[model samples]
Target: MDTFKKVTAIRGMNDVLPQASGRWERLEQHVRDWLRSYGYANLRTPVLEHTRLFTRGIGEVTDIVEKEMYTFTDALNGESLTLRPEFTAGTVRAAIEHNLLYDAPRRVYALGPVFRHERPQRGRYRQFHQVSVEALGFAGPDVDAEQILMLARLWKILGLKDIRLELNSLGAGEERAAHRAALIAYLEQHKDILDEDGLRRMYANPLRVLDTKNPALQEMAAGAPRLLDFLGEASRAHLDGVRARLDDAGIAYTINPRLVRGLDYYNLTVFEWVTDRLGAQGTVCGGGRYDGLIELVGGKPAPAVGFAIGMERLLDLWEQSKDEVVGQAVDVYVLHQGDAAARRALQLGEQLRDAGLDVIVHAGAASFKSQMKRADASRAAYAVILGDDELARGVASVKCLGDGSQQAVGFDALAGTLVDALSADGDAGMPEPSAAPPV
Candidate 1:
């Protein structure tokens, strides 16, 4: 019998090692903290969905459906299934399937992997993570403004710098239809000037011509009529209101007319957060209003708006900037010595826990030297050591790892000592906790 070839993770897929888990946890924690403060509850959806959901929802003309979707037929039923290319489509699908629209105007968020079979590059992967926030069943420009503002708050929380928000109004149906007609006529005139993709995009999605990377086409696109000029009074007012609110909130932005987002469902208030620091594909976050999304996904028409930030891209930025993430709660690391000392250390750990401190104790398995090494790697400020001698004397060694200062105290006072050491500087070197070990 022929042996099957040894399997490996598909190209563009990579394992995140234990050393990098801390960074991922930091990234998610940063996002979740802001989301909680803003009152958005978490919502999770499966990784696979009916393939046609994306085709109808993501727009067949867009590159995602045109080329990049990871589609396959379900083995059991032969239904065409796909690994989601992006979040909004599946999010809307889930909302509709669950009858979430009845709860009209729910603020929901999700963080998970989205798969797209595209040529991968630095910061771009076949399987990537996204944090998306959706506000469903609200139809006002205020909803749009809130969405953008919340995204701004999230960026601030991430401590990302030099990130610029690019805002655009895709306008309501009639107004966008008018803009598309004008854009089509313009693109048709310069049809010969476009490359194959641009030319195809012209007929399929002429507005996308404005997003072309082709230098010549881009030059011609510069002089085309701006979509904002064709906006109906309502869209224009909505756009103005969003801008005004952003200004009042002290968030900076630029209005770019060409930013008709790549999805078909988006309508009005499209935006992207970009930075020059990330090469080429610099859009770290993008989202917009999708009023018809619920209806398109087979539910009642619910006006929804949201944004999704690429976690990989976000982590890239945070690593580069060395931004501070809040909620570093690991306050103490307890090091146990011999057999009985491990039991005493565990008791002390519980005492510290009862004092409302975050405590971690070394598993009794590791050697004392190994435990110290783990403590150092954990970046714990206070390493409480309980050896055989200290245990017999009814005392413990609380060593401040930073200054190498050791204090021997009664075992009963161990919790207070740890708390005092932690409370001294508050934020000084509150090292992030390590990721949970693999099972």
Candidate 2:
């Protein structure tokens, strides 16, 4: 026999197996409902896009472009392509390509996997899902504040706690330019305190240096020039407007002058929802206004703001804070012995399904004891047992998995019986099966 090597999933890429997939499904449903409530429609873009999109849209100097992106040349066309490191760049590109803003400003959201070549750690993955929401073509601070308020509602919906919001402004091009000049000068003065990463990004992307996680540079970065100070009159008014709305909404937030997001496109109104529950990977979601990105991505200049929540991190926080349990796979499990009974069981399963109850018929040969064990393990509310005698009498023994009460339910009455039993249970603790009249 020839030996074969086992193939495994790539590092940092993970499978959402059945046991954990229930939680993912629940989280996704909550996200969909939340986005819908805010009038944000869904927009989907492909996982792969032209590499120039991110380079031009996200800024060539940002870490996503310089280091994390999974870039490759197409085998057939020889054109450079990349797996999207984030959704905003692709969202803007799609909007421009499709003339999404020709009519009016659009509020759109995307939920899907994003690829990045980063080391996997707690709550961070190479292939991770993001809930991205973008409000394109909207100006003024109201839309920005609206997005922030939307996030606050989501945290409440998810029952997540201990997560605080931090806000900052990057100002406009000239304002950031002034801040950049002053920041570079400050960094140059503290060159000895800067790490290799900080020194490399010092002049090319000086703002990122302040956002560094390096403890050695934290003190120096904190002391550097604040972007809020460099804000011009318009920028100041814009930040103040967002703050006013947030204050009115009673959403508490901090003005962290050093909260420059990792992306190069953000110019104003950057914020992050941070939590200590997930250790050093504390940021569960972050986004900011990227007013120049639409124009840079070959569209008419449109002001836009958006945010992306890391599903993994958010799910982690949700699990920590909520005591939710995954419900049973099926409402009823059907088991039968003998060929005629097996045939009847299949029909019964479909009939129960038609009546709007989830039903699974036991497959292949199995003893009653064996099938009952499987039914109990399935956590079904009731088990419909059909053997030769029960099938001959045109009735099934309905055993309540909860309290072991068994009743004879005729074939015509089985679906109605289970529905009533399930409705009475109401997804609270399962109650004992009520007595059924003689068939």
Candidate 3:
């Protein structure tokens, strides 16, 4: 047989090792609890879907469809599919296919991995995770304002600072079309200054060209027709409504007229929560009202608004905040010597566990000194030591790792005593396992 070769994770698709998992868990739980508080149920859709779902939803002319989709055809049936680049398109597809909105207007959330074919650097990844929140069948700006406030609350929970919000309105279809014509005319005049990317998107997606990072094109883009100036009465009122609600709640925001959603679907209100902390990729969350998407996806006309947060980037800020996302302190590490005592240690371990303590039964044979060293390494509050002599007397020695005090007690009373000591602060007896440390 040919020699087997070592395989590794594909580039930009990373493995979540033990050390990083604790932070992920903490962030995910916070999202779940926060979503539930707003009565948003969880919805899960497949990661792989028909390629049309995105091309039709995210806009064929956009960078996501034109340059960044991981598309493939099934070898068996020859159907085209692509790893979902974002959650909104797929969520709307599911809602329309299953008639999920028939019962009532729904607020739902989803958390999962999404893929894109792009250079992975710093916080950007080819395979990344997002926490997507969507509210369907409601057309007013009230929900839009609520979603923005909810994000402000999250910053408080994470102790995130130096974050700011940029708000804009894309207007209804007709107004956007007029502005599109005006913007194209302006871009054509400055075609000499436009770079390759800007020229490509000028007529195809004129709005994206406004946000380009090219220092040379910045002034030229700034002189282009402003979309906010083109907003009609209805579009202007909708944005004003959202602004009024945000002001009532005392949330500070800046109105960035150039903050346009390049996709065909987004309309009315769009917003982005940004921070200087993440360097070039500073948009931590972004979304807007996509009222026409449900209809495009084959459902009765339903209005929807939502946003997604990039987990990797947010976790980067979480680390910056110095929040302790690791598991709670270890309660006990059980150490025993001799085969007989090891056998008895198993039972004693269960008894301690039943009394509501975290007990890790030390395995294999090791010297007393080695066992004590491992126990201290565990960072546990106590070390329960069982030896051949202690087994013979039906007693065990417990050492308070915190104070280095040792006491001998009958095996029968050991569990209760440890439980009392650890539970003094009223923590659960059978507390959930904390993040596992590396072996």
Candidate 4:
């Protein structure tokens, strides 16, 4: 008997099986299309970077840096590294490292997995994917509004509704510093009510304490000095500018005073697209202007703003809002019996694929009814059966799975016949077939 223990996927990291991967792919394609429409190019960064890159860029006191980062020491070099907790820091690092902004400000985006050591829940995972979009070296509220509008357009394209926008401005450094001083004093007065987490972060990151979810401290947090009250004129103007643009575009938003994003780098104009459906994880997407992050990440001083969409959360909402089934996997499923018929089936599949059709040729020995059942299970639009008699006659028995219609087409005319039939049914224009030949 086999005695070895079976291994399973690590906790908090789940595999995307075929059943659900289709939805993931569809969402990803929509994201790519939406980003490209705004001229945002793709930017990919390595998953690992030096530990200080995050510690300094994301802030030493932020929860992501202090608690959630997956950090390790490299045995070869005796240096510490971390799987990126978020994309902003790494995107900025890449922009500076490659001098991408030397000629002009760039709009680039990254899509990939991010790592964090956190308890997994529905729509939240230790290994989750993100579509992070950044506009580097652009220093105006217009760009900020543009990013917000871009998100609105995407939601419309995705047919997602009831996801409202909440906006806030962290203001510039001096303004926030003033707010921070006042906040710390307020928290000091309420130290008796501060929970362990709030007390620990009260001084180092008092702004975050206001964001605490502790039910006991809700009243105290609400009573703390609002950051908006302390905004300087320039900071207020920037916020006003963004609001004006959003108004011009007919976008509705609320100025959430406590919407300070959980990052040290964010200053000025932070926003989140939140939904009520996801329960505790309400924020589907969040980002803000981090004007100083470029310099913080070892780049020359430059202004930048960006946002990240948690794919898992976005997908969860997408599944709830949309009901359209994912398209059939293949345009045609070829089934055959007997050696000669199987060979002909393979050849016919290749011919159909050459004319821009997805073809899956059945393999192994199975009865005609069994093959038909397999073809139906594949969700193919049409099934081409090549029995020995049909192979001898140099024709195929084409059956439409959708309408239960069948026709006999000669080998030379099979591709054109199917194409014409599919086009008539409004299912033509199939994507290029896979490079690997049908098995």
Candidate 5:
């Protein structure tokens, strides 16, 4: 028999370190709070779905399905299943399976990891995090405008100020059919100049050929048919209304005729948020209307609009602004000299916590100098010292670590003194311990 070696995580997977998770949690809290204020409820679907879901929902021509999908045969029943490449497909599957389409439009949001098999780069990964919103059974351009504006609000909540929005129109089914013909004809004229990927896109999805970022292909495709020219009267009016609403809300945007999202289901108005701070894959959020996807997935013909923000990409942007990401500050670290002192320290820790202060108790016994080093490393502003000498007098030394100033306080006054010392004014950069840190 051959011996087998233990295996670790496969390539393209990564463990989030403490500093990164702190930033992620801050971003998540901001997103959740904003979603709550906008009446978007949380929804969670399974990580794995029937393989056919992506095949039909994301479109088989897309790279996510043809190459990047992690599909397998289940051992239990031999059914084909795959880890989700995106959230929208699984959300739609759950909505149809659970009968969430009966009464009114469903406004739901989700945040979790999505899997894909691809070469990982600076901001791209095989296992990545995503935050998405799905608005089902809504058809008007007003709903489309609301979804776009909601996403902008989320970016504001993250304290991301330098961002740009790109908007486009894919028109309805019949209108798209006509546009597809004109687009293909243009690509055929430039067939010899096309690269391999561009050639594949031309046949697989002529619309995606317009979205290609290849400098040569982009130059060639510049004279191709623009979707804006082919938009039917309804789609034209709808897109105009969307832009008008955005302008009314003081949202800035650029109208790009070539902004067709990769997914096949999206139709009518489509938009993306980009930041020049991120190179290459600059789009942090992308979404559009999919009026016929519900019926394609076995639900009724329900119109919907949604978007997914690449959390990993957003965090990358946050890393560039870490100095602004407010980290947790330790209110106090109790330094005890002995067992009895440690007990008294624990008592004081509990008291401070009850009075709404963040307190981390010292573990085990160590020299006073060593304990001071630990307290300084914690970024804790205050250190409570209870030694044998101080315990004998029924008092503790309260030292402000920021300035090394020491004052003696009675045991009964420890909690109140600490709370008053760390109280945050509205303008203070320090965040309340109970609230999540900023990103």
Candidate 6:
């Protein structure tokens, strides 16, 4: 006999259990619906792309490119391929390859898993999911404000609190270079305090040193040259325009000069929606204008602004505060006892499903009491009892799970009856069954 060995999922990577996947599904649907309402079309891109895409798009000196990407070479071609660390680069690559911006701007959204070789924590994971929203070809501050306001709507929809917005303007390339030179000059004098990592990147990408988590460098990093002061006339005006619109909409924000995004392509407006609930991974969503990304990724020069929310972070926050979303609950649970009833139950399931109802027919014959238990556990609004008597009469006893009321409905009436009961109970979120979640 062959010996077997135990295997486990890769560390930092995780499996979303069946019980917990409901919240993910609900949150995804909620965000998708909200994005669609704003005329954003769904965009799907490949998970693996040319390695240079991220290194060039996100930046060479960045942590993601330097230490976190899952990159490997193709055996036959010798070309480097990388599972995406973030979706923006892939999204932009797709836009360029597909010529999506040939005529006009496209408001697009994508949700998928991104791989990052990082230590797993409470809200951070090696393989994580993110929902990225991108607005391409729009150059005005109006679009920038719209993206921020859209996030506010998301928080409101998810019933999230304690999340606040922080904004900054990285200025244009010229202004950033000016600030970079000054920053390098100051850091040259403070060499003693520079950590090994900071010393290495002092000249290559000095701005990222400001983003360090090192307690020893926090005060010193804070006092580093502020990019906000280096904003040229155009950069300052662009930021002011965004702020004015935000002020008009009553969306409050703080301008943190040190809030340079971790990506290289970002320029002009940048923002992060942060919360205290998610431990050190406080940022739930972060994005800003990446006007140079399109050009860098071989597309015609175009302006773009968007953001991505970590699914893990969002799930954590939702569980802590807004755990009110209805999840994975069917509108009807069809219970059956014998072979004959099981056959009828399957037929009833199809009928209810065709009539636009969420039904989970009890599979594999079990005791009536056991089936009822399963029905209740399903959190279904109704438990459909298919006993011998009801089967012979071509009727099903539909018990309202929320209440104790029970009634007999004919096979033809079961779908409508369940629908009415679900409607009466205000369980409209469960309409037809959705596609299986990515558990």
- Candidate 4 residues 1-439, lDDT tens each? 9799999988898899986787888889999999999999999999999999989888888889989999999999999999999898889889999999999999999999999999999888999999999999999999999999999999999889989999999988888888899989999999999998899998888888999989999999888899899888999999999999999999999989999965556899999999999999999899899888898878899999999999999888888887774668789999999998988788888888999999999999999999999999888999999998787677777888887877677777788778877777655333222221222
* Residue pairs in candidate 6 whose N, alpha carbon or C atoms collide under 3 angstroms: none
Q: Kindly report which residue stretches of model 1 are placed more than 4 angstroms away from their true locations once superposed.
A: 1-8, 262-264, 323-330, 343-370, 426-439
Worst lDDT 10-window in candidate 4: 430-439
Q: What are the lDDT scores of the predictions, listed in order?
A: 0.81, 0.88, 0.88, 0.89, 0.84, 0.87
Measured by TM-score, how close is model 6 to the native structure? 0.94
Candidate 4 accuracy as lDDT? 0.89
Worst 10 residues of 6 by lDDT: 430-439
Q: lDDT of model 5 at residue 144?
A: 92
Model 5, residue 389: what's the lDDT? 87
**Candidate 4 segments exceeding 4 Å error:** 262-264, 425-439
- Could you give me the TM-score of model 1 versus the true structure? 0.88
* TM-scores for every predicted model: 0.88, 0.94, 0.89, 0.94, 0.89, 0.94
CA RMSD of each candidate after superposition: 5.5, 2.3, 5.0, 4.0, 5.2, 5.2
> Where is the poorest 10-residue window by lDDT in model 5?
430-439
Tens-place lDDT per residue, model 6, 314-423, is 87887777546545478889888878888888989999899899889988867888888898899888888887888778778778776567767777766776676576
Q: Ten residues in a row with the worst lDDT in model 3?
A: 430-439
lDDT of 3: 0.88
- RMSD (Cα, Å) of candidate 4? 4.0
CA lDDT for candidate 5:
0.84
